[model samples]
Target: MKKIAYLLSVMFLFSAFAPAAMAKGVKKEKTELTAEQLVRVGEIESRVAEIKSMDFSEMSKAEKNSVKTELKEMNKEARALNNGVYLSVGAIIVILLIVILLT
Candidate 1:
């Protein structure tokens, strides 16, 4: 049992460290918004609000479809402009556990 456990731990450690040793450093993406980007984001928000306020019931099928496509494109652009790190519940819990264990 002792020999088996020892071998397993050694295998785990080797597998873990090997990836870190072989992997190249990755370039991080830009997270902060510039002045122009901030202004664009504001414009996107106002446009979305304006679209929401309009009467969709009166529009034709083709007009509604066009509006839908435009909104999707604007949403994608807004998300791209608002680039930032987002940690999930599981990630936060794991980080907390790691911190507690280390301390």
Candidate 2:
């Protein structure tokens, strides 16, 4: 049936990329990045979105490399920021509890 075919194709697509996605996720979480890296990520994300919106099958190797680099750097920055937020929130809660106890 057509439905079965569609499902098979979807499964194939997912299976093909699942391992790569998992690896990327791990790599992203392990890196420490700077603000410039974050900005590069935003730029790369936007470029990727644009590329997806279009029907271009051919992209320059340099362009692809640039985007990949930006995304990787951005992921690193995000992980750092996420940890920073957790620390700040924990500190704030501790301070609030101390103030409440004193008052």
| Candidate topping lDDT | 1
- Residue-level lDDT of model 2, residues 1-103, one tens digit each, is 8677656656765675688788875643555667887786677678657755754357777777776786677667656555642447876775565455444
Residue 35 displacement in candidate 2 (angstroms): 14
Candidate 2, superposed: residue stretches over 4 Å from native: 1-56, 84-103
- Whole-model lDDT per candidate: 0.77, 0.64
Task: Score every model by TM-score.
Answer: 0.53, 0.31
CA shift of 93, model 1, Å: 20
* Model 2 per-residue lDDT at 9: 59
lDDT per residue as tens, model 1, 2-96: 67765665675567558767664765665678899989988988999999999999999999999899999998887677775466899678556
**lDDT over C-alpha atoms for residue 79 of model 1:** 68
Which candidate number would show the highest TM-score if scored against the true structure? 1
Question: What TM-score would candidate 1 get against the native?
Answer: 0.53
| CA error at residue 93 for candidate 2, angstroms | 36
